[model samples]
Target: MTMANASNPFRGIRIGSASGAGLAGWQAETGRSPAVVHKHPVTYRCPLGHETTPVFADLAEEEIPEYWDCPRCGRAGSRRPGTQPGAVGPELYKSHLDYAKERRSPAEAEQVLAWALGQLRRSRGEEPAG
Candidate 1:
């Protein structure tokens, strides 16, 4: 007697189960899904030797964290707490101020003063006179 042919096990198998099928079904039913995004907080240690500071989430790219100082190991970088997206810490304005103070030049001081005046004028919506 002749034996019957066996059927293919995966002949009509679909590519996705319930979870994976949602994307396609939802897209077909609706237009699209909302995009997901995240804002991550960062922490930075002082470049000098002092303390570690937590950077604020709303800070701009150029604003450094408060209380940031690393006198011993001298590491300067932001560390993310979890597996979130991260960005480079802000520039240390205090370090720049200290450097400018140590220079102690009249012309440099005058330049800084002028820059500050210009910034003040701009903030107040006034045109800075040249």
Candidate 2:
């Protein structure tokens, strides 16, 4: 095979070239820039029958966005009126008690509580009353 036909192995490659000369003045930042961001949920609806709630993070001094492009249809989506931003879903919360109620019957839970109280009483060297 001819020398020209033989691959140089380094073809189309430049080593140690400073192509990023424009960013010479840029400094590496330690820690976080724009630290402490707040989030808001904004809803976007497309004409193509697609809807989404996009949560956007806003910097401490920046304002939350009111609109976003629909990801499915690539159409402009405006924020719904009176809708709050950052997290989507009902605000109703379930505590540990609520979860326990869902997983156990009332009578079973009462039995478990009674057993726990008896164990505690025995550990403390006291007789548990019936």
Candidate 3:
């Protein structure tokens, strides 16, 4: 044995290798042309006026949502309808009261609550509270 093999057990041995020489790997990976996936750009602007455009695969258009999170400010962004992302226009703004109105009218909620309380009282076999 040579002096070099004396220092290390694995020095003279290769544990494993590909079927062929190094060139085989290059041939297997880049031997032919590869196709690129298509992408579409979607733009959004947050209420704070931060704009960001993110690219999505063309296949994902159906799954893309109107709002996206801003990469910088972390706010949800809105997409402008009927125009490309660069266009600026009025955006609908909603307040807490607006959202609440959509959920329930004051009288409607009171009726639902009363009905729920009556059900609970009947379940317990107790007199319904006024």
Structural similarity to truth (TM-score) of each candidate = 0.23, 0.37, 0.37
What's the lDDT for all of these models? 0.53, 0.58, 0.67
Measured with C-alpha atoms, the lDDT of residue 56 in candidate 2 is: 72
Location of the lowest summed lDDT over 10 successive residues in candidate 2: 22-31
Error of 1 at 40 (Å): 54
lDDT: the better of candidates 1 and 2? 2
- Per model, state how many residue pairs clash: 9, 4, 0
Order of quality (lDDT): 3, 2, 1
lDDT of 1 at 1: 40
Candidate 2 is scored at a TM of 0.37
Over 52-115, each residue of candidate 1 has an lDDT whose tens digit, in order, gives 5543546566663433434455444334322222345434345666777888788879988999
lDDT of 3 by residue, 58-120 (tens): 855569877776667655677863332233433345667778779999998789889999999
Supply candidate 3's per-residue lDDT for 91. Answer: 36
Off by over 4 Å in 3: 1-30, 81-130
lDDT of 2 by residue, 1-130 (tens): 3134265643441322223532111121232223355686666765455788977776442474555556665555556643433454323345678789999998999999999999999999999978
Q: After superposition, how far is residue 84 of candidate 3 from its true place, in Å?
A: 18
